[model samples]
Target: MSRPDLFKGIVSVAGGIMLPIDQTLLPLKEKAILIYHGSNDDVIEISKSIQDYNKLKNIGTKNMELKIVKNANHFLSSQTFKDEYLYEWLEKNI
Candidate 1:
């Protein structure tokens, strides 16, 4: 599928400080990347996306949060949504 089509169902079900990494700038180098900090609007957008996805999938929000990483695309690039940062955020929020 096309790149955009592949991420059509993407969503973010939690909120927190996002240290989104820049994958396009990876391998050949590394950098500390962050985006959408303290942005309630962005967080809400993410939450809506998640909610829409869940509804489409016939799922319920038994346990969900409202937040997201910008420029990370779906799959949340390794550089953009690194495990360490994600876990830390999840630990604090969830």
Candidate 2:
């Protein structure tokens, strides 16, 4: 999808696929923060995070099912989050 198709407005589109883990309200709240960024540096950090996610996902079974959302940034905040498309995709795949 085009970059424009990713966002609902100005925000990233990947936000919807998240499982609502909030890191800001952590430890006490037992939340997992979804880190979001808009720069190249952030992109690199996010890529590393995704790699880490893949690693974790690989531990349970010999065959791993991995889905990488297209055009999504580190926080999974693509423009696509504005609609239910990403959610539907995740529901179907994950």
Among the numbered candidates, top TM-score falls to 2
Q: How many collisions per candidate?
A: 6, 16
lDDT of each: 0.35, 0.36
Q: Which ten residues in a row have the lowest lDDT in candidate 1?
A: 25-34
| Model 2 misplacement above 4 A | 1-44, 61-78, 90-94
lDDT of 1 at 18: 38
Global CA lDDT of candidate 2, please?
Answer: 0.36
Q: On a 0 to 100 scale, what is the lDDT of residue 20 in model 1?
A: 28
TM-score of 1: 0.26
In angstroms, the error of model 2 at 71 is: 6.9
